[model samples]
Target: MTNSEQHTEHSEHHTEHKHIVEYGKYLFIWLGLLALTGITVSAAGINLGNWTIVLALVIASVKSLLVLSIFMHLKFEDKVFKIFVWVAMLTFAIFIFFTFLDYSFIR
Candidate 1:
């Protein structure tokens, strides 16, 4: 092969190497999500008074994190991307908190 052709092949292999992920990791994440789903369903059958919503949201948040980090490849992304995600989440939480606060004052 010519030098240029060899260089092209090497670069392609390097790019492909970065995207390789372990199948076991995805399987474990899937199982974890399934277990969390089971908990959410079981919790729905019981009455926990005012704490039910909190419990469900907590579980949902955990599931979301797993999907985002593992499935979305955010865990392998740069620090800047992670920082942006955190900022976005923080902003969303603030908005949700204010919404609840508004509702509390209305009643």
Candidate 2:
């Protein structure tokens, strides 16, 4: 084979290797998150008073992280992308907090 053909083949192989590794890592993370979801649901049914919501939220946040990092490929993305995601999350939190505050303090 010509030199150019050989180089192309090598580059393709490298891309395939990276893709396979990423897929395997994401699969493992997804399976673990699924198991955690089951646990969270079970815990929620046990009547933990206020803590049930907290625990469920914590578990959901973890699952969101896995989905963002693995399924969305954010783990390998640029810092700016991550910052944008954080900003969006902060905005959502602010909206929810203010809504809760308004509801709790209404006359």
Predicted candidate 1 versus true structure: per-residue lDDT over 18-54, tens digit per residue: 5445899999999999999999999988999889999
Q: For each candidate, what TM-score against the reference?
A: 0.77, 0.75
lDDT of 2 by residue, 1-107 (tens): 11222232345334211322356786799799989989997998899998999999999998999889778867766567899999999999999999999999994
Q: What is the lDDT of residue 99 in candidate 1?
A: 99
What ranges in model 1 sit over 4 Å off?
A: 1-19
lDDT, each prediction: 0.83, 0.77
What's the alpha carbon RMSD for model 1? 6.7
Scored by lDDT, the top model is 1
Least lDDT summed over 10 consecutive residues: which range in candidate 1? 1-10
Candidate 2: Cα lDDT at 31? 92
Local error of candidate 2 at residue 88 (angstroms): 0.6
